[model samples]
Target: MSSDAELLEASREDAGAFRELYERYALRVQGYHRRRTRSDDAAHDLTAETFAQAWLGRARFRDEAGGSAGPWLFGIARHVLLASVRRGQLERIACERLGLFDRLDCRPAAVEPQTAWLEDLDEDLDRALADLPAGQRDAIRLRVVDDLAYEQVAAALDTTPQAARVRVHRGLGALRTKLNHSTEASR
Candidate 1:
């Protein structure tokens, strides 16, 4: 097996090599974020950011202390996590200083009925999602809405990644069929 340093070097020139590197560690890093974060959604966001940062900084990767890239990746993941935390903290502090906290909505996933359009579609999609079996609905929610990696999706669902993927696919297919019917009826 080639060392991660070698893989990183190759990754600079070959996208496939980079994909291989990403495959080697993405789940572990995502799991690391998941364990530390409050919710899978936050963990998903941090994991995406971590991999993006790692890709951008691949040239800077050093094979320190036994040539495994896991430590280097974890370092980047840590920084990403800290940056996310700091951004939240700074935003909260700024909101406090500016007295915007009372004006701001702190909750997640609020779909306001005030939209001129698409609100109906949002409700339709919500209803369609609700109509799905719990396994499929939860899988779709975690994989699509929250943007969790399939591995993380599996962990949350207590199933294999492939099974989680199948549930998401089936859920989306059902949603598409239901929405198509709804659209035809409305027209």
Candidate 2:
């Protein structure tokens, strides 16, 4: 069993090697997107797009996670999902501008009680994130949301790994405090 780094390197010559990498991570990557989008089809599409980007960009692969490519692949997944979301938002805005939003029978799926609760939790999370300082917020997003390694997070934030870790720790603490307060206040 070759490490992810070895698989990626081998993929440069034998594309089949990349299949091993996909088999290792495809489901996890799709699940990540699924949890974020709450849409199965979108998850599948985003997973495909993420893998396609990885395949095309294989040659440029940097072993940031020692023998693991989890962080790199996840980084791509995050970008793909963000792009998809941005496109969705822009389309909604365009529809609204053209008065098509109201005209369209865009009935959303009926939300289950559990889903409604989850949606509220998501809003609370967004609020907590908004309360963080910029550096801490970005660090937390890279480390927690994107699942990047400390090194990768540090690189993205142009800081040391120790600093990245500290920021994520502090940011998460703040979020927990805020959410706890919100929960208590709601009671």
RMSD for each of the candidates: 14.8, 9.5
Which candidate has the top score in TM-score? Answer: 2
Per-residue CA lDDT of model 2 for 78-175, tens digit only, reads 77766665656566667767777556443222321122212342576688889899999999889877979999999999999999888977776677
Encode model 1's per-residue lDDT on 1-187: one tens digit a residue: 7777788889899978878888887777776666565357766777889989988999987543234676567667777776766666666667777776566453222221111221232565678788999999999889766979899999999999999888977776677577557545653
Model 1: lDDT of residue 108: 20
Candidate 2, run of 10 with poorest lDDT: 108-117
Cα displacement (Å) at residue 80, model 1: 1.3
RMSD of 1: 14.8
TM-score of each: 0.52, 0.54
> Stretches of candidate 1 above 4 Å error?
101-187
Model 1 residue 85 lDDT? 62
